[model samples]
Each structure stands twice: as C-alpha cells, then as structure tokens.
Target: MTAFHTDDPQPKPFRVADRLREAREAAGQQQKALAALLAWDPAKLSKTESGTRTAITEADVRAWADATGMSDEDRDETLEILAHFKVNEKSWRDRMRHGRRSVQLQYNELYRKSVRFRIFQTVWVPGILQTPGYARQVFTDLNELDPDTPRDVEADIRTRMARRDHLYDSNKSFEVILTEAVIRTLLVEPPTMLAQLVRLEDLLDLPNVRLGIIPQGRRVRTAPQSSFVMYDDLAIVEGFVIDNPYQGAQAERFAALMERFWADAVEGPEARQLLRQAITDLPK
Candidate 1:
C-alpha cells in the first residue's frame, strides 16, 4: 500500500515493458521484427511493450532475452524484476478463476504440512483463527467483489474452517500478532465480530499459540507494511494490490522485522483483557 503502487494500467518504470523495450532497441529490432523473431504475434509483442498484457510469462521474458542476445547478468536482473512486477499490479481476486474453495484446499495442505507459522495481521483475523461466522462474511464480501468468478461461500467457509484442524497439533506452533483494529474493524456484523473476539480470548489458553495484540494507541517507529505469514522461512505477504510470496533474504527480513511488532505487542493477560474489552464495547 506504499506510494509505489497504482491501480491504473499504466506500467511503472524499470518493469517488464521498459526492460523489453530497452533490450529490443539495443538489439536494433523493432516490435514487429522482434515478434517475428520470437514467433509471437505482432500484437502480443505490442501489448507486452505497451504494458497492456495482463501477464508477462516466463517464456515471454526468456524468449525476448534469448532473441535479443541479452547478457546473462542483465537477463537475470530483468527476470528478477519480472518476478516482482508480475504480482505487484494485481489484486488477490485475479487468481480466483477456479474459486476460493480451491485456494482454501491448497492453504489447508500448506497449514497441515508446515510445523511453525508466524503471522502479522493488520486487518481482519488471520485465516486459521477465524470462526465460521466470521469466515462466511469474509468470503461473501470477497466473492461479491468478483462477479465473474463462480461463487460458493458455503464451500469456501467449510474449507477454511477445516484449516483449523491442524491448530490442535502440539508439534506445530502459531505465533500471531494482531493490531487492535483487527477486532475493531466492522468487516462483518456486530455479532460475528463479537464471536471472533470471544474466540481470540479462548485462544489465549492454547499452548502452541503465542497471541500478541498491538494496541492502536501504542507508539511505534517505522510502520508495519502488510499482513504476512511466515510458513517457516517463506514469507507470504498480503497487501492492498499484492498477494505475493518472498523467500531467502527477503523472507528473512520480513521475519526479523516482525519482531518489532512483537516487541510493541501486549500478550498473555493483556491480550485477553483487550479482547474482553472489545467484546464489552461491542454493539449489543
């Protein structure tokens, strides 16, 4: 949600199109000539260069690099940029062609396989922590956003609620941090939010979970960027226009920075107290 993001279709600098344009120009090939060289339609190359193509595939990048005789170093660098920019311009809904239930099953597998999870949520409750009522509303709202996609909120809710099964495993851990605004957000109905808060209170007794709640009024230095889940070393970041995964140094950095939020967080009894207060303050 930083200033670098834009909803408009206009491509950003140093992205795929700019890099492709630079390489093609350096190789003395115009759009039509390059398209013929790569056996691609001229319009495909044009749309790619104009940033109108919704997706720039890996094959497209590699073919362009190979055709232009790009240096290995420059090709690698451009590939990295391609990787980052691909997901940078789209919402999470773009991936839901099959529907939310499909993704939920995929996540259920991930949750089952991973032994440790470190989560930082800035908005609604984390998926594993959501109750049936809360999850239903969440799926409904998101599904409504994409009318073209096949809608099945009940199936999505069932699949999502099933993900909670792994929570009881003593070998696995769920280290989660939530901002005060999570429970405060009226993304769902009053009763549903109230139920979610009550569920948070119960999670306090869970031996494997270490719940931390960052009070809204708490002073902090750098702002937390996005909601992210670290399934071991991998960081899956959720942003306004991004639903991307990071690994290696990038993922490590996300995990390290999460410590700051944990440091500012109030846990144990304090977290329970906040949840109860939110419940008490709820619309009755």
Candidate 2:
C-alpha cells in the first residue's frame, strides 16, 4: 500500500440552507409563499431549503435574498458559504483521502441506524452481504487502484465483514434484489464466489432477510443502470469511484426505483434455487 492523499472532513451543505430558512422566517414568509413570490416550483424550494439539490444555484440564492429582504452583508455571506459548499459537494470521494477502512465504517454506521435496507446489484455483490473471502478479493483489487495514501486492505475487509452482524438484528429488515447477472458474473475467482453463494444461502434462514433474484427471462422494467442501496431514507449509488448519497425527495425516488426491479424478481424458495444452481454451475 502506497501513501495516497486523503480528503479532509466533509463540509455540511445544510449550513447555508439553514441561513436561508432563518432569513425567510425572519421576513415572515411561508415556504409556499416564498416559492410563489419567486415563481419557483414548491418542490424546488423544498429541495433548495433541504440542501439536497447538489448545490443551490446562485440565481436562486439571489432571488431568495431579494424575496426574503436579506441585507447586503447577509446575502454576501450566504453566497460565500454556498461557494465553499459547492466545492466540497462535487461528486467524488477518494478512498485514499477518507481511507478504505473509514468507508467501511461509514456503511456500518448506516446499517446500525437504518431499520430497513433495500439493496440492488447488477455488477457485484452488496458489500454487507459478501463473504470474507469474496470481500478480500474485492479490497485486494482496490489496493492497486490508488498509490498515494497509506493503504490497509485487511483492515477494510474486517470492517466490512463486521457489517454482516447487523443482518442478525431481528428488528431490522433486509430486502435485497439482484439481477441474474450478479450471480452469473465471475466478479471474483470461482472459490471465492462459491463461498459467497453459501453465505447468501445461509442468510435466507434469517426471518428478516428477503433475497430476491430477477432471473434470466424476466422483463426488466428498469434497465439496471447501476447498483444502489437504500438504507431507510438515504440512498447511496455505488459508482465505480464516487458514492452519491441522496436524502429527502431524492432518496424517496431511489426507493421507488428499487420497487420497479423488485416487481420482476423471484423470492422465497424460488430465489434460493437460483443460488443453488449458481453454486453447481461454478467452475471446479
């Protein structure tokens, strides 16, 4: 593992949003009233106020300042904060900066807090459900991708493996849907993949876990573009490099999107058959 540049603490986007909301309230305006005054959609206003729109637009900020009767200094200060917010909010999070182990721990935090998990995969297995052998292969590959920061593949793997314990919590619910391709695809060596299949089968006995497989021949209503996990209200798109997180209305849309694929999936004993067959089909 080489030394890689790591990212500093992430700046929260909600600071500027809080300022805008406070200003609006001080001016004695309702959210709907402000939206109407600016001729903006109420949904837009809500997203902007929620800080869930990636970055709030400068035009919108100026318009908001005008509508809310914000003084010049307050308007400039808000814009300055928004400027800083946009810089950090750009779509990439380098594991080198955050450390590979840190990322795994973050997911652990999500698993601990979320009462429900909706996971969909088209390329690789979901991190939390992976067998230790399979996860080791994953991080071993990831180790080669970046050379700047001090790396620890073993530590990261341990952190991720620990996430599996959260699945045993009977009060929590796990709904995972995978395309036929995820199981069929040789993402790792046959031995590791077979072990992963065994782990998946074992998970079936858990009362709260529901595994759904959209086997081949099924019509996909939503052409799977990428894999995502909805941990209750938050949705994280597991991109090749960046992890895009969504909350508020955006997260709700992700949950709805997962439902589209869920409709085509086979669950219960039928899903188990797919796993068993995949294990049998694995190369000896």
Candidate 3:
C-alpha cells in the first residue's frame, strides 16, 4: 500500500487522497511509476497524493486512472474527487493572481446555478442580503491593508450586489439564518446601520428567501460557531476563515448542522418582530 501522511484537521481531503493512493498501490505502482505513465513529474503526483497541491483537473484524474488500469467505475469515483478538489481549493494567492473579479464572477455563477442555498451567519449580514453600504463597510474591513483596497472594495460590492439577484430571481431557493447579534452590532455608522435594517426589511419580502433570526437569548443554548455557507448540492462549505474551505463529507456535516439550526430557528411573524426590535434597539 502507498503510505501517506496528512495533518489536515478535516478528514475529507486526506481520506480522498488516501483512497487514490491506496488504489495506485493496489495496482503495484509507485508514485514515480504512476507519474511516468501519465507523463507528469513525480513531484506533482507526490504533492497531489499528499494533499499539498489540491487543484486536480478531470484530465489528471483520468490520466491517473489509466495509469493504474482502473475500471470505469473507479475512474468515475476519481472524477468525483477532482470535483471536490476544485470546490475546496483555498489558495488565496492563486485567486488574486487570476484577478478576484473573475473569481467573484465564477462564485456568482455558482450561486445563480444552485437550486438551493443554505447559509448561517454569526456576525455581520450575509453578503447576498447586505445593502450596498453594509457591503462596502464589510469589504473595506476585509481589505483595508492592501494598497488597491478601494478598487477591490468596489469590485467586491458589485459582486455582492450581483449575488443578491439570486434572492429575487425566483428560480433559486434561499434559506438563511442570522444570529440576533448581527443585527445588534453596528458595522458602520448609525445611518448606515439604519439603512441596512431597511434593506433587511425589504429582503423579508422576497418569496424565495427564508430568513431565520436566532434570538439573542438563544445564543447561549446554540453555542456560536464560525459562519459558513452550504451550496445546494452540499458540495462546498466556505468558511469565514481564509485558509479552511470544506467539501465532501465535511461540507455534508455542516449542511446537516444547518438543518439542525433551521429546526430550532424561529420563523414567521415572531422572527420578524424580533428583527424589528433589534433595529429599534440600535442607536439613533
């Protein structure tokens, strides 16, 4: 068997890479042997199998399958791994090199194509529902150190506005829950917060988007966790942390967690009332 080592706290990627490595070993092939079969350098294979490099294409997976004499079923399984690899890659430098605008466009495409979006935000408003002012404040906070922060800020705002279209498009369904503290905390000045409150009021009118408010008092019971977004296919969970994106089984776990949040979540007019109270309590 191919011996592999991984230090990833999340089990999914390591498990996937281990499986592929095992398959190669079962076929009696070394990393260098497999690399030679696929006309790739041995280091590339080593990096991929070790989970150091994660952006494997379908072609690479197919080549690996061919090198190992894997059956069609095995090839299909490897293709799925390639899909997960694409979804979970978190190289921010690569994103910047390719231009974040294009990356945002691709994200928008994913949002638009998804039939359902499950999101839980523990801090500020979720991007899809944020008002432009709130979005600007958020982007500014996130990009303040960069010299091109202003341009990046504008691009991010536009990207977020584009993402908001999914809420009203009627073709997609959106289920979002926010902690009461998100409404309680003022991300910007009072007037901006007021306008953001108004925006939430407007978002409540969208038929496709279901908003749940976790009351401030409920915070103790639920235990605040880092925020995450689960796509409809449950293939990705984009964490608030820059380095740690989750996919495959890890994504599924978060999706299930969102379901639990939904079960205990308040909805209907009572939730609306709580949201209104939150706005009223904000400083004038």
Candidate 4:
C-alpha cells in the first residue's frame, strides 16, 4: 500500500481521488505504470492523489475513465469529479502562473451550472460588475509590484471584462454583497472609479442579480474580513489558495452567512440613494 498525505480537512475529493487510485491498483498497475499509460509524469499522479496539486485536464479524466473500464453511469460521475478537479487546477494556475486570465470565466461557468450564487467582497468591486478600466486598474494595482506585471495585467483585465456578461444574463440568480469600503476605495483613477460606480448602478437593475452594500459605518456583528462565494448545486467555498468544490459543510456555513448579510442588506430606493451618495462623495 502506498501512503499519501492530504491537506483536505473535509475529505470528500480526497476520497474520490482515492477511489480512482484504487481502481488503478485493482488493475495491478503501479502509479508509474499508469502515468506512462496516460503520458503524464508519475509525480503528477502522486501529487494529484495526495491532493497537494490539483489540475486535471479533461483528457486526463477521459483516459482514466477508459483505463479503469468505468461504466457509463460511473463515467459520468467521474467526469463530475474531473470538473471539480479542473476548476481547482485553473484556480491554482491563475495564482501561480500569473499569466492565466480566466478566473472570471471559470466562475461564470460555475455560476451557469449553479442554481444560486452567494458572494461577498470586501475590497474594490466584485468582478461581475466591474467596468473594464476599473478592473484593469484593480489588477494593475494588485500585480504591479510583482515581476510578472505588464504581461499578466492585460490578460487579467480581459478576463474580468468577459465575466461581466453574466450580470445581464438571466439564466442564474446571483446574490452579492459588498462592503461600503469597496465603493469608497480608489483602486483606479477618479474617472474610472466613477465609471465603475455607474456600472454598479446599471447592474442593480438586472432581475437576476441581487446587489447589497454594507455601510462602512454599519455595525459589524459577525465575521469581519474574508470574502467567499457559495454555489447551490455543490457546496464549494473558493479561497485564494484551495478550491473546495465539494465541501458540504463549508457550503452550508457560507450560505447561512449570505442569508445573514442579505437580511441585514439595505435594498430598494434607500439602497439606491446610498449608492448615489457614495458616488457623489468620490474624489473629484
């Protein structure tokens, strides 16, 4: 028996990965032998199995399905696992490669598949409603000091702009809450920040999108800093490091958090009025 370490505290994906590994072992193949069959480095197989690294290409999943002689039903189940794996892979790539520019696209795809989405943002605007220039400025500010700077800047901007299409699309329901500070923060120049504020106003009109702003002066009762999103179909909580696309408990906690925030959210004419006031206060 080969021993492996996993960082997952919940153990759902790790169990699924273990099942796939067991199937290979049942067929009397070693990790090296299986990697050779899939044309992947043996270490890649080990890292994936160990949950240290997760980036499964669709091709890799299909190969595993075929190699393991998975039934039609099982293959579909395996593909779901692959989808989760791929999402995590893309996330890690975005963080590490710094050139990868599709986090918003990936989030949108997940949103489309999700019946409900709950999001919280503390700094700057949420990606779904950010104007292109504002997004560029935000990404530029965040990444400028890094060596990867200019090359990654444009790609990140494009990716964020592309994600905005989901705001207008009616297929999925989105619930988003932003801290009042996000509105006041000047990630971009004055003109661009004004554009972003206007964009948020436009987004509030969308039937499918629910916008909430937590006043900077408002009382804070619960958790104070981190932001997260919860998808309905699957309970996944995405963070800066790991994407747990299948954690049921974490999903429930965030869903409850969303409800708490939404209940406390100021909406309708009053909300719009507050937004207007925030825009007026923007530095000229």
Q: Judged by TM-score, which candidate is best?
A: 1
- Compared with the true structure, what per-residue lDDT tens digits does model 4 show for residues 186-243? 8778888888888888777889988888776677666546776666635444443344
The alpha-carbon root-mean-square deviation between model 2 and the true structure, to one decimal in Å, is 10.7
Candidate 1, number of clashes? 0
Residue clash pairs of candidate 1 = none
Please write out the lDDT profile of model 1 over residues 174-243, one tens digit for every residue: 9999988998888888998888988889899999999999898869754866899988776777743235
Error of 1 at 114 (Å): 0.6
Ranking by TM-score: 1, 2, 3, 4
| Shift in Å, residue 124, candidate 3 | 1.7
Minimal lDDT window, size 10, model 1: 1-10
After aligning candidate 2 to the native by TM-score, how far in Å is the CA of 257 from where it should be?
A: 1.3
Lowest summed lDDT across 10 adjacent residues in model 3 is found at 1-10
* TM agreement with the true structure for every prediction: 0.70, 0.68, 0.63, 0.61
> Which stretches in model 4 have alpha-carbon errors above 4 Å?
1-98, 102-105, 145-150, 233-246
Summed backbone clashes in each candidate are: 0, 6, 0, 0
Which has the higher TM-score value, candidate number 1 or candidate number 2? 1
| Ranked candidates, highest lDDT first | 2, 1, 3, 4
Position 77, candidate 4: lDDT = 78
> Which residue pairs show collisions in model 4?
none
Q: In terms of TM-score, how similar is model 4 to the real structure?
A: 0.61
Give the per-residue lDDT digits (tens) of candidate 3, residues 222-260: 565878776664434334323244566777888878877
Of 3 and 4, which scores higher on lDDT? Answer: 3
